[model samples]
Target: MTTTNKNIENIIETNMMGYASYVLLDRCLPSIEDGMKPVHRRILYSMYLQKAFNLTKSANVAGQIMAIHPHGSTYSTMVGMVQKDRHSIPLLVGKGNFGMYTSRDLMPAADRYSEVKLSDIAIDMMKNFDKNVVDFVDNYDGTIKIPEVLPVKFPAVLVYAPSGIGVGFSSSILPFNLAELCDGITNYLRTGEKTILVPDFATGGYIVKDEAVFQRINEEGFGTVRIRGKAEIVGNKILIKEIPYSTTREAIIDKVVALNKSKKLQEVTNIKDLTGLRGMCISITARKNTNMDELLEKLYKFTPLESTVSANMNMLVDGLPKVLGVWQTIDRWLVWRRESISRGLTYDIQKMTDKLHVLRGLEKVLVNIDKAIDVIRHSPEESIDFNLQAEFGIDEFQAKEVSNMKLRNINESYITKKIKDIDQLEQTIELYKEILKDESKLNELVIKGLEETKESFSVDRRSEIIELTQVKPVKLVEEVQDYNVTLHLTKEGYAYKFKGDQEPMLKPGDKVIKVFETTNKAEVLIFGSDRVAHKVEVKDIDDTRVTSLGTYLPNMIRDKKIDIVSYSVLDKKHKILVAVYSNNRIAKINLEAYEGSRKILKNSYCLKQDLVDLITLQEDTKLKIVTDKSKLTVHTKDFNLTNGRNATGVYASPARILKKVEVA
Candidate 1:
């Protein structure tokens, strides 16, 4: 025998694909036909089979379900959590502490402590099991059979939404009101109109209906919705009556305490949770100076009072995972339902046909009572059935039934009852046949069942949908008014601003090299030794006392040992400027090109060894240079404006060292 090694990538791919298929099909995703995963379906089926619809111990139910589901702990928790949920029509009615939706920490007691029973709604999902409406496959041990999917009479997916995380995909479907779901199905069937659905959470909250995402969800079956806890400010406290769907009383209190400790919730002084499993009630006391509205907004910003619910309409379609739109899901469900109902009717018709055969055989016996008695009394028991079949033109099954018939069944009154039963059975057979043949009749039956289910399980929508107004963003810094201001810079590298107009108070060694008049709204540019230009907004420079030293130049420009060579106030009307470097290079460029914020302005330019001076200039303007050795002059048109700030310019002067450059 020869042994071969498989490629590592191929092995990994095969393993991962198998794992994903298991997670998607058996664990996470629900069947669209029944809206239940295998575990949930098994739990319900076990209860139905055991006739444990009364208050059966949850542990016993779990034990029964383990025959089908191997993992006891996980299914126990799932059963406890799902049964206690008050939002949709619960599949199981549970007693005792079945945990809660508000707090994940408060887990329900061990399954032995909790009692559970199936609800009427859950029974309806398996209504036609005995009638052969759905297919069943062998159980895990092959000891028994289990349904592949329930023959659900109505749409359970929309009413009781699913949320699960899987291998590569997950789903978070929101529950809707039962009445609305029924109406939607009816309307969709009647006029081919798609019904719009909104989330109706059991833990009542407010939904921002005007959000564009909600509209997209209704149209495409995937989007996000914003939910806020119901809150009101009264007196000195804000009372939250209900929190978001996933939020809990304990969690909300913890969040508030954490926010308060961090000072993020400035107005909140104390927090308390008076919530129970029934509903939410949280009270937060505010400080004396708190603005109630702003306090609530802060809470919403920092706490779980507001949250988002995502919609991902992923389910099993034809035994494959697929994301469907809203109408597409409804349409597919209707088709499945039509087929199931049709199969059920066919099963019923066959049953009636079988009964009519037996009745007709009995009718023959009634016509010839004496011959029937002789055939039954004198004929050998083994041959009696064959004799009866031949004599009465009946099949083997009917003949066997006659041979085994009791004496009471042969009386006159019993025969009359058989005749009436045959007539009724014949009528029932015709009705079932008609229902199967006509499509509209089938649709009407579906509509009727949906309406009846809605009546049995419908409740007022707990979540309120409202068009929330978009809140404007608040600015962190206040706006400043424009006013006349004077800027002064010294050769010693001191920069200051004065209100109105004032002369710089310079020390004996210091000299005021540049003084400019600009408004508070103006942006002042500083040329540095590092071949970079820095900008400062005039409003940021506070007015200084005449006797005090000005703000250090390094603090303003972010460079040390660098004196201000020249400074200019950017003007909207004048976009051109000229720069002269100590290396005797001169360039003409747009002033707007150098415009940047205080931090970013440093990298805006490149220079030679040092910067000589920069001046605001206009197009077609001429420039002059006064050098240490000599003077050189040229027209601005001698060179073109360079687009890049780092570009070294053409020489404006022949002198090796230039002292100053100015407009001629």
Candidate 2:
């Protein structure tokens, strides 16, 4: 039993390891040299073969390679993904719907209808495929051969960013502009100078490019760039022209709608999805008299209008998955390119050397032509090599070439052509030798290739980079939405905000102390026994007619057994707050002294003692205070308007129990 258990464990471990390897190599991660997943490389190669056969249907491309690929994924979708502009450069140039950035309804067309071909970029990258620059491996069933990695002459990783979810890790390398990449590479090669690569998505927007983020991505293989949408305010509507990378118009609209529904964002009245064939165009309709700037900033905060794109550059290196930074990946790709070019050069040199040998043998034959012809004609076909070897001192390879030539072609013109070709082939071989001997020549060759590619196929930068400080939230004047909600707070500490059509609920001893209407975003002050006034947003409290919404009290009020005395939405009309305590101490304080505190209950800005009563006053209003001994009437002019915020007022009648203060 123990042996069986051990065997099972061993089998499970081996299978899991194999699965992880497959996921990282063949499925999830891409090669550092070729910058292609195994499947993508196969798909592109199949498409490459169809270039001469004219454009192939997307379905055929997928169908041809689907057998060798292990995944059960939809192949047409994969083709569309590679062919999509992605708001960035695509590997395959395609004609038809390949999806869009801003909406769900725009999916790629069916594989049967769509046509695709390898882009000039892909063609340039897959240069010298027939040469021995790359290695080929057997298919999944071992029936056919395929290149292990596409011999990409350029770095496909940056031209088209790679993203995948693999076992234990994933990769997200952000896209860079083709023209910028070409220029950067050229500049670096000419002068050992480096330029920061800011991610440029095809969907133009603003990127909060931080030097540190780029540095981290170059060193740590991971960092994030903040992207924000572009918008303008015209009259009452805010029109969004471009949104953040990977965010759709529908996504931004959904977020705005959610925020509005939850009362978190109240200024936006309607969201319009005006996206069309041109590009992303979303119009946000805001309420009249609304602070458009503030609302636009809120849209950035509360919606996908502002988002981050993370770059985690994990790629397969020599069949093993490894994390590589931006510069490291590029440098490694250069190394690979140079090596592939050198191999190609070596392959050429070797071929020319063989051709030169065969031509030289024929050169010997061009002389003493009659003797060679007599030896060949008289000798049997089986003994041709022996006869040639005996006649001239040429080896088996040269003799084989001589025997294989057609009898009719062995004439004066053929001899002249062979002699000319021999001279040219020898000169070409010598040139290849010189290039192979010098490293600088190879560098020049690589740089030339890059310059040619840039000239032919490089694309312009799409996304823009701005200073990080630009998108940081700024405080602006805010005028809340027009839909005002009425809030009712009782003396017994119950509070509820209701629409005009709703009724307020009350229990015994719950006397309504304050009734005021304000926007849902506006806050109302609550006075409690702690000698402090706390604030609660009209929207923060439950807006309902059914239940007694939970009391909007400070954390300390219930623990300290203090009843909420009053609620007031203090505005410009109310100035002084007169407080009458049970100890017969009454204080009149300026209402303007109250700071906008967020606490549910903070210390009152005016009152310093326990409250028996409180009243907000205007310039002409008179406060009538009734105490145990007498009633005192203090006119607004008589009150000290310049009193401190926490001052306890002088007694209405010294040494008398205070009762209440009211407008007189």
Best by lDDT: 1
> What would the per-residue lDDT of candidate 1 be over residues 132-207, giving only the tens digit for each residue?
9999998889987999999987767776777677898998777788888889889887887875778788778888
The TM-score, computed over Cα atoms with residue i paired to residue i, of candidate 1 is: 0.69
The per-model lDDT (C-alpha) reads 0.77, 0.73
Q: Tally clashing residue pairs in candidate 1.
A: 1
Prediction 2 global C-alpha lDDT: 0.73
Per-residue lDDT of 1-664 in model 2, one digit per residue for the tens?
A: 3543458788899999999887887888888888887777877776666562356677777676565665654455465455444636566766677666455566777778877666666777677877889888888888767788887656778767778998798988888777788778778777878787777886678888689997887766889988888888999999998887778787888888887776667677788988767766798898667878778888878789999899888888867878888778888888888888888988998998888898888888887777888888899889989999888888999989988889887776797797788778888888888987887788788788877877887776767888755655643224445456766767766776777746676776667787665567766677766656666555556666676554545542333456566766655455667665777666677766664433444557444456676666555567777777787786656656644655666656675577777778
